[model samples]
Target chain A: MRVITGREAVREALREEMQRDENVFIIGEDVGVYGGAFGVTGNLIEEFGEERVRDTPISEAAIAGAAVGASLLGMRPVAEIMFMDFVTIASDQLMNQGAKIHYMFGGQQNAPFVMRMPAGAAEAGAQHTQSLEALLYHIPGLKVVMPSTPYDLKGLLKTAIRDDNPVMFVEHKKGYGEKGEVPEEEYTIPFGKADIKREGKDVTIIATSHMVFKALNAAETLAEKGVDAEVLDPRTLVPLDMESIVKSVSKTGKVVIVHEAPRRGGVGGDIAARISDSEAFYYLEKPIKRVTGPNTPVPFSPVLEAEFIPSEEKIIDAVMKLTK
Target chain B: MELSEAKKLKMYRDMWRIRQFERKVDQFISRGDITGTTHLYIGEEATAVGAINALKDEDYISSTHRGHGHAIAKGSDIKEMMAELFGKRTGACKGKGGSLHIIDTSTNNLGANGIVGGGIPIAVGAALALKMQNRDEVVLNFFGDGAMNQGAFHEATNLAAAWNLPVVFLCENNQYGMSTSIEKAFKIKDLAKRGEAYGIPGVRVDGNKALEVYDTVLEAAKKARNGGGPSLIVSETYRWKGHSKSDAKVYRTKEEEEEWKQRDPIADFEQILIEQNLLDEDKIKEIKNEVDAEVKEAVEFAKESPYPDKDEIFDDVYVDREVEL
Candidate 1:
């Protein structure tokens, strides 16, 4: 019903959720007064006041630690990490404490919170460009979500806000500016459900975040080459939609898992393994292919950095190898 | 000296309970009945009992890894704690959290953290919660001397001081952090000075004396409740045993241990009780026996309790995990 960029969708999600719940508040560096680093929280401080939209000192540990502590006391806190790379500074609070609290306490408490970080490669060099969704997904008791479209971003972010468990919601920096038709009315996308962007039968192309766009682009190119590819975008990584992948793999009899993260120990490997383990293996006419970044740090140079992330050309090459 | 006889007697009883409980846990852990590393609070009973006694039932306390004494002092169920240490299904955290993670939210006793200085920020946050809620309750963050050097300690202290939150940062400087002496960790011998940097009043108290710690905490708690902001009470105490169950006490000599043992908190309290004629020897012995029996009953209950089911690992991760498309 509405046409908005991914950034606007995220801003709307935070605003709506903050307005809906009294206990909910946003805290991060430059969130208030200066607005968020990505401008997603622009003018929110004026709207919600400084109490609800707080700007914190540059302490990831403190921000995350306070959020965890606040969440423990029945507050729904949404913390922002300016870049996904900086989350390393607060990994202790995130992985050791936040992720373990609910399970360690044996259900006595839950860290009902959301951590928003701008992830993926754009112009930012090696450190800022890395997408570490796979690392977070590896941890238990955490919901890791990456939304591709504005509609999914809005709905899924709202869902993450209300979720009782801690959610690591990673937004691609480049995807934020991408325009999409988001509903004027409110909506929420469920976790672990795969969205089939364009259904085909030649190969099951599973992607996430920015890679969804690339996969769709590759799908169009593959159509010209007479190779129909079914593109599936799984918004969440933790509660992954294995059924959708398995079903598509069953029909297509070939698969390609694509992600922006490094190929070594990447989510693509996990998806490929699941497909192999599932009953869909019998239908496989060709072995599964995984299109991922190389096992190295994201490069500083734009050309090398672009190579570090998966590309549509590589997807096309992998698809041609499988389709042949 | 002007404290009521009832108050004096109650302090003696709680201190006796903590001493008895720690001793029993030591024996149980040594006998292999209780699994995992146990941090005994044998010599530092006064620090926990006295400081905790100063707090109200609703007041929150963030505990350290050597937290059994603090937990017991904060009114956590001994039975559940014992069961948890035994890794039983009916434990405080359903046996997932062992000796170090025992927590009872009902009693406002936050979970003991494994990482050193981890609970400081949590305590500060809890105090901030109280402030936001406009509640009169105060938070007592219990840490050791070694935690003073941790980044979390500095960050938490600075934040608490800046916010003027209702919290008492009770540093139980028990001579050593594991085997490393506090003297070796810092240039200044005085631990209270570290708190002064944060612009809050810091007090150095005799950790061996229950009355001293009790009075100090009473003042701090009162100040916090009255919106006077946070204070640091560095209680200089000593641990009777090594840092953990496996420690051989290689760092300190037998003489050093013996010297501190002479000023034993329980013995010191017992002497006070006798001198004041508040509790006779027979009454003290009766209290000790009652504590011993209670500890024994908890051990029995833990031994009888069943281990948690294997499938429980997947459960309790979150409140809900609905499949969404």
Candidate 2:
């Protein structure tokens, strides 16, 4: 086992996957020489050479289009959108062509590629900071992944690269510096499985991406107040871990969903609605609450952005209210 | 490109077959047997047959909404295509994709696009894959004149030129975009000149003349296969009917329509066949009857085919959905 940051874990995953399959290649803006915008794909070009680690022009649509075409023909292309906000440039390509090709052609096509996007707020202004997991989850064929730890990032990312489907690996920009122990041996994490970060009986805290750490913090703070909280991290949202979520909810009989995205029309609402629809509804002791950002763009100001994000205090207060 | 006598007759026969098929589809739509609307390929038979007839079936071709002629020319089954139009379980896409998205995997005909320039990027991507695989195959992408204005065209073309990918961007300029005149859209009469933007060779040919399309595409295909990169070929044709079944065709004049009808691709090809002594009048009549019977049987087959089951509606969305949540 080795300790590495989420960024290095992702690079290792790409390096290992490329070595495993000759058809696997990397394509995006500045991925070749510049080592990716966030330095996640550093030295990949040196190891794999330029042809395999292609540095495309600043064309998100072209990158997505090329990835879609290349993957359909059995070549695994790992495309990177510089930021989640910029994915709008290629949304049509992903939403329309990449998502519907197989079904529209009667299963004659397969878009087996991974699009790595650095998402969520990282002191970047409104244009650069946005969590688009909800939009991606709404699309049927596109698989959505948001890993919180180095281990999960490597395992899940490798799986995404290998699967014969289009997967959006949305890495949290803040989570890149977060360190975790990853196995030296190769491994793959299956989707739709939730990790019980902490097990308790008072309330179930369902957190995603970077919010998992805050939820963990809240659980620790809740322990002091005699309110035991359970933190569950659902790594993949599309192939969601409903069974695990309901199991946690059933154990606790109360749930709180935490995410950095806005509350009005976000993925948290989907999870809350699903829990209400599932067998967990009868087990709920209190109504589900969402601790999320407001329905507005992330501000450029540091104080305002900090206030915009869901804090551990907010999570703890929500848990305390449910416990009371 | 020199063609044998048999090959030349086959080209005429394919063009005739496409015309008959389009006519049958029109009759079916009018009679309410075929559902939904279609962008008919009535006057552009020569453009499709001339291009696809010269390329190998393994070579990929991305088509536009008016795709039946391209499908037929690229060796798709008329029955499956007709069944798809009828929305049947026996359809090419199992009734999932209708007339605008017909696809035949047997001949590697990529599914047609509903959006104007959507298939352009897809074709470029396919060519990139071919290059990456070190395969000698080429892609022949078909779009209308109006799609040239789409951003997808520019991005795909620029990338194709930069990467030196093997693709032929074949434009069927039928002079209108759902009743909007091409002249109103662009100032250039020869739309192929747009290829200069990417620094690739662009050629224009009389679309009503099928042989010209065949030779031009054949040359492009050879150049692409020999690492000459991509080229754009614009076949200047005219749409004889409305864009779809609902088109009023108020944009063009009756005089203009009559002038184009005088150069009907199928009729002119028939005349050429007779003058070349390759097909006598009796032989011409026999081929026409054969094609008529073939299209007629396709309609019959589509009529007999069943609509897809409702259970399959959710299937094929993904390769696997596991247990539904």
Candidate 3:
């Protein structure tokens, strides 16, 4: 029973996994002596040595492709693409090779590698701040993980490392400093399972990554207005827990999906479509609403940036509109 | 580097096997027996067979789109490869990966990549894995002259050189990348010189000469295995056929093709074998007949194999897991 920042939770997961398995090594641009751009890999090289904690050139493709190749040879590589936006540079290796290797090779081999991508708007301009889980989730052979809390981050990251498929582990940059209680003992959360942060009946608020916190706060405000909101987090997007999503919506009869990603072709659209297509279609009392970032790139100005990200007030407004 | 008679004969047989196999593939494609596209490795047999002959069975290899020769050189079953091309259940990748993506883990062949330079970094990674585990093994990475222009080629080569990973970067300069000639792609005459930027040793050899390619690769592989780091070797060769099944080959003159065809890798090596008394007329006839029979059997096996079950279309997308998607 200890409270720690989300960053520390990530480091702990990595250290524990590295200690558990020798094949699990960290490779990225600044993951070595520099301790990562966000300080998530601080002092890991000191413990794991430079060999295990590898420092590569500023080559995202090589980092990703090398991880894929190493994973095929029985080594579990945890590759970090410093920012989510830079994943585009490594997209071919991650999407074309890593994601398709297992399937394309007819299941004879699998690249059991983890690519850690720090995402979300942290006042950085468009290039450095973007949630790319939607892109990864669209790929068939990849598993996408986005955790909002320190406890969830530690458990889910450990699971991602052990997973036999390519995993896109998206970490919210803004939530790195957020603190939450995590147990000292070892545990791992399974993929495709939903975590109901707050249980209610009037409406279901489905959120991902940093948006989950806003949804939780909005549920608190909704309770004050005498309208109960259920908060559900489908932590892993690829093996999405549609079962839990439909079950929650069946009881609430209303749903509102929220995320920092842009509205156009966002994961929210997919979730909304799935809900409407599922047996829960009859349970909907109102059209499923989405509170998401606009289709434009993330702005740099503080005021515009604040307006860009989904907020607790916006979630409350969506819930109020549905309930009213 | 004196090669034994047995080794010489094996390399000769492997080269002929690739030639016959590629020729059969051309016939199959023309006859509409195989759908989609395939990059034939006809003229480049010496490069694949010679370089791969230097590697041990435990060593790994990463191949390119035109990788049938690499698969055969690495000792993959031709039956499985033909079946894979036929999209049958008993194929190398269970029909998931066709000609361009054939993978045989049993022989340590990393799947052939569809992207030009995509397999380079993966091969580097495999070498990195070998180094991390303290294994004395090297990975032979096969790419084309066209791959030299790809970002992946630079990134992967730099990483391999920096880490001193046990890998040999073999560039089979087969003249053209689809329709674009290497002359238009690279400013430099020798593609091997690109290794200077990465601080790795580079060598060039007559890819038409199987013995020369074998010697060059053997040396590079030994250097890599000794922790000396990676080497880049440019095997100057050509493709006898067009880039793929759809290519009409309008870009090059028939005279140029005929000129290169005269320096055929198989015939050149066959001449050497005869001169050394390692092979005679009877032995030459015997090898051709044996290779032809093998190709015939492979085609028959592929024809008799059943297509993958329709219900299993969703299979092999992931390992050990079933999803709703």
Candidate 4:
């Protein structure tokens, strides 16, 4: 086992996949000699050559559309959007074309491309900071992946490349620097599975991406307060591991869903609805709670941004309300 | 660039097939057998047939909303196309894609896009794939005058030129982009010159002349296959019918429509074949009868095909993974 940053883990996954499959290539802005805006594709061009590690002009629509088109022709292209917010510029290709191509074309073709987007608030102002996983999750054909640790990032990214469908791989900007243990041997995690970060008995705290760490911290504080809270991460949003979510919620009978995205139309609401709609409804001792960012643009001020992103205090507060 | 007699006759036959197919589609829409509206390729048949004919059978093509002509030109089974328009399980898209999205991957015909300029980047990507694999096959991207305005066209063309990918951008300038004439939409008369901005060679041809289009595209495709990079070919033509079935004849004058109709590509090509002794009156009538019979069979096949089962609606969203709805 080796400890590495989430960024290094992603680069490793990409390098390994590129070596395994000649069809795999990277296409995006600043991915080649520039190494990517976040440096997740660091020095890949030096090893794989410019052909496999393509650097494109500042064209988001074409980048996404090219990935879809190349995928239809049997190329596994991994397209990178510098920021998640810019994905809006590429939404037509991702939503209208790539997401609907397989179903619309009567299964004659499938767009097996991975669109890597760096998301979450990083004090980069309103336009640059936003978690758009909800937007991608709503699309039927897209598989949404958001990993919390280096291990998950490495495993899930490899799986996304091998998937025979469009995958929106959302990486948290702040989580890139976070370090975790990863095995030296190759591995891949399957979709539709949840990882319980911390096992507990009194309450369940569901989170995703950067929010997973916040929930874990909140669980640590809750444990000292004599309230044991379970922390669960539904790693993939589209093929949501509701079985794991409902099982944890049924045992605890109290739930708090946390995410960095805004509360209105957020994935938390969907999880809440699913819990209420399932057999877990009878086991609930309290109404489901949500600790999410308010419905407004992320602020530029560090203090405001700190408040804008859901914190460990917010998670603990929401959990206490349900537990007490 | 002399073409064989068989190839010339095929160009004429494909042009006629598109004309006759579109005419039947008009009848089907009027009779309420086809529900959704379609952008008929009545007058611009030569551009599709001629450009597609210029490519090898293994080459690929990306089409537009008015795509029935391109599909036929690229050898898609008309029965599947008709069944798709009729919304049956036997359709090219299994009844999911209507007239707007008919795709036949078996024929290397990438699906027709409902969005203007949407297929441009996809074609560029396909070309990118071919180039990466070191394949000699080229891709012919078919779009309209309207798509030239889209940002996608600029982005895709630039990428193709920058990478020297094997693709030919064939713009069918059939006058109007849904009521907006090219005169009002573009400042320049020749849309081909736009290729200069991306540093690719541009050529404008009379779309009514099938042989001219074929010659121009053949040269471009050859250059692309030889690693000379992408080119832009603008085929200036006109759409005889309205933009769609729902459009009333109000944008242009009837005199203008009749004037363009006088240069009907099918009739013009038929006359050329006759002059070359490639076809005679008897052969022309026989070809018409054969095409008419084929069109009739396609209609009957489409009419008899079953609608997709309701439960099958959940299929094809993903290849191997099933998502919980």
Among the numbered candidates, top DockQ falls to 4
Q: Write the per-residue lDDT of candidate 4 for residues B1-325, one digit (tens) a residue.
A: 6789888888888888898999999999988989979999999998998899999999999999999999999999999999999999999999999999998989999889999999999999999999999998999999999999999999999999999999999999998999999999999998999999999999999999898899999999999999999999999999888999889978899899999999988888888888889899899998899999999999999999999999888999888655796
Interface RMSD of 4: 0.8
lDDT (tens digit, per residue) of candidate 2 on B146-235: 899988888888889988899999999999988788879998888889889898999999999988898999999999998999999999
DockQ of each: 0.55, 0.68, 0.82, 0.86
Per-residue lDDT of model 1, residues B2-41, tens digit only? 5678877777777777777778788888898787888888
Q: Write the per-residue lDDT of candidate 3 for residues B14-91, one digit (tens) a residue.
A: 999999998898998998899888999999999998999888889999999999999999999999999999999999
For each candidate, give the TM-score of chain B. 0.96, 0.98, 0.98, 0.99
Measured on C-alpha atoms, candidate 4 has an lDDT of 0.94
Per-residue lDDT of A167 in model 3: 89
- Per-residue lDDT of model 3, residues A1-324, tens digit only: 889999999999999999999999999989999999999999999999999999999999999999999998999999999999999999999989999998888888889999999999998898999998889989989989999999999999999999998989999997799899999999999988989999999999999998999999999989999999999999989889999999999999999999999999999999999999999999998999999999999999999999999989999999999999
- What is the CAPRI rating of model 3's predicted complex? high
- By TM-score, the better pick of 1 and 2 is 2
- DockQ pick, better of 3 and 4: 4
Task: Report the TM-score of candidate 2, chain B only.
Answer: 0.98
DockQ of candidate 2 (2 decimals): 0.68
Superposed model 1: Cα runs more than 4 Å off: B1-4, B321-325
True contacts kept of 3: 0.77
Candidate 3 regions with alpha-carbon error over 4 angstroms: none
